[model samples]
Target: MALTGAASAPPRLAPGGVVTRADALLAALRAAAPDPARLPRDAGALLGERAALAGLRRNGRIAAGGRARLLCAADGWIAVQLARPDDVALLPAWLEVDPARFEGDPWPALAAAVRDRAAVPLVARARWMGLPAAAAGGGSAEGGAPGMDAKPPLAEARRAGDAPPSAAEARPADGAPPRVEAPPALRVTQAGTPRRRHAGPWRVLDLSSLWAGPLATHLLAGLGARVAKVESTARPDGARRGPAAFFDLLQAGKESVALDFRAPAGREQLRRLVAWADLVVESARPRALAQLGLDAEALLAEHPGLSWLSITGYGRPEPGGGWVAFGDDAAVAGGLVARDDDGAPLFCGDAIADPLAGLHAAWAALGALRAGGGRLLDVSLAGVAAEAAAGGVDPRACVVADAGGARVLCAGRSARVAEPRARRPAGRARDLGADTTALLREARA
Candidate 1:
């Protein structure tokens, strides 16, 4: 058996909350399903969306602590994500959908059918683009997992480093007339296709090196998008060696294009791809993209509907914005490093912030697209690490020290708790004192 997606299935019910995959899936399936009066066209859209949602939700609550809603097209290709900033684990699964299946205008009935087939329950009233109620199993109403959350079509058709598309292909989804006016900033464009709409597949220009940045486009690849992972031969991706760990994990469904963006021609070629991209994601430091001539303003002027994401250690224009730093786990442990009285530093065991922040960038990009809103996503590793510790106390504050001893720190606090044995009781000492007194008197005589 394929071990139905749940690992140690969460309890059917939890207190201070109502979380049950079965119920949420079932409810979403029922609500999003089209009625003759509502959806009018194909019901299959709803079904497919529901099925994909069930699969994405199956992983249950991830360590970052949030649930995700999967948007699917009839062909089993997931189109978008409705995950919150905290739900980072959903990216991999989201990236797995085929691009050929995206529907810019999704069918309500089809989404419902998919839900029914997957046996996923739904929580009612989830709506997007005037669509019916829908819900991913664990999302809550207000935000975060255990609540309400909001939430790809692909076309391959292209390998990495393909020549960029013409100006027409780079237009935004705003339906505005093309403008000939030039802007002071970099020249750019954006494009966004809605669910259930039969739009041609697109290529992604990925200007990220490591796990967090490239991971977004890697996901885009899984859904049938052609992701050209842009790298520089001068600065190779860290994943190329680090256990070759993230290379496969992040680039699973994508192709790579190593380019020297620092060179003049590289910028022109990149602009061609930018003109061709429906979306662009970067893990560069703040203003770094602009230096390379790929900032949001430049891109949006040419392609207004384009969705852009900027994943970073801190944030652009914020304190420490451009300062390069470690991923979430490393930064957190380093920031909170608790030195023993001996002055030795200790760190946490997980590298959590990178992936969590990466996933948030991915989810936000998709959400903005679905809503037809183009904006820059400023995701920070430190911010995400802080979120992981939410609702919990700081460990350092309550730490207890041990008493001085030969015991190794491994013994923990036992050195402090132990007390030395007391001297013999007064009664036993009295006899010894009397003997001493008699000896003294004899000597005197």
Candidate 2:
């Protein structure tokens, strides 16, 4: 598929070239979809929807959503995100400072503490403590070189652990010394089987929260999939706590099944739900699912027709698998930041990586389904961001300012920054666990 839109079309919908890449993916998705009309006409608009709903703006140093910041360390720059209270509580430990030193707002203290520290070590400490942080321009596309703009694969599909690693998977894309620690951008883990076309709408079990995974299934739902979203009663989708309208936009049209995985009955209900699904979309870390006895590899082995989409901050491999990351920091990890006139990196948009990954994940899932279903698709926020960055317009040339305000320029054209627009919620999103009783009863039957 083509990686970009036509030159006559607006190559960018926002400051960076992400919208351009998103447009390309959306075109491919529309072409491949059974119902092309179900997808949005301009996927670029989806990139800014979160920001528009939240009234977020592009701050050169602050993330569009205002939850993350780009700060200068002694050696280089780094991005840090404290989107949750739990993340804030760990700041003292991450910075090795006394908790008493921080009070009302933490940014001032954080900036002071990080200013004299080296970026790499601080990022390392933050990741070790589960805080989302990354050094600016540190990512390597396909394990090329740190900060190189080469394109990386959107998803890495590999055969489960039962199969041996292929030679291509064992080496870096650049033919450098072997670094098996890094996963390849994309690989065909399992050979494609004859297409196993579904007789009816595909049944999708979505066990993911937040933007990327839900957006993937939401797109699928738009394309006539029967989607059931499984949540935990104890800890439901955190999005439920945010703007209800925003939550509704992503969760609309999907039946809700809330289960407490801690309970034996709930676990069994989850397994039964999995059995009922033709495809599964989840964003949990590998270990989190393994603890629940719903390991993807084993499940794929057990169900020959199953297709699994695993979305994470990084690919499911050592080093990356264990690390913690969020959208802003993951984008930074992928070197997907826009550059200011002085060459300093700035966040391109609101959780840019999440939407990009969401688009790629949905497209990959559909491709897997078309190829007859026994596939494990591994998509990472950082990897997708890198791919967009590699294929994106030059950061320096993307934004220009006039008295009218900042405008994005691409492919010899200029356009005003587009506001995020939401499609009317497909339908009102069902309340959390609203379908639990009926779903569980059906499973029992």
Taking all chains together, the TM-score of candidate 1 against the true structure is 0.43
TM-score of each predicted structure versus truth: 0.43, 0.83
**Candidate 1 C-alpha lDDT tens digits along 161-182:** 3332321232224422111111
The root-mean-square deviation over C-alpha atoms between each candidate and the true structure, in angstroms, is 30.6, 7.9
Output the TM-score of candidate 2. Answer: 0.83
Tell how far residue 437 is off in model 2, in angstroms: 2.2
Off by over 4 Å in 1: 1-198, 328-346, 393-445
For residue 83, what is the lDDT in candidate 1? 28
How many angstroms is residue 129 displaced in model 1 relative to the true structure, after the best TM-score fit?
Answer: 47
Model 2 Cα lDDT, one tens digit per residue, 107-220: 989888877666655665566567787767542212112444222221133222222232123222332211111233333345223335357788889998889999999888
> What residue pairs clash in candidate 2, if any at all?
159-189
Tell me the spans in candidate 2 whose CA falls farther than 4 Å from its real position.
1-16, 138-188, 191-198, 395-412
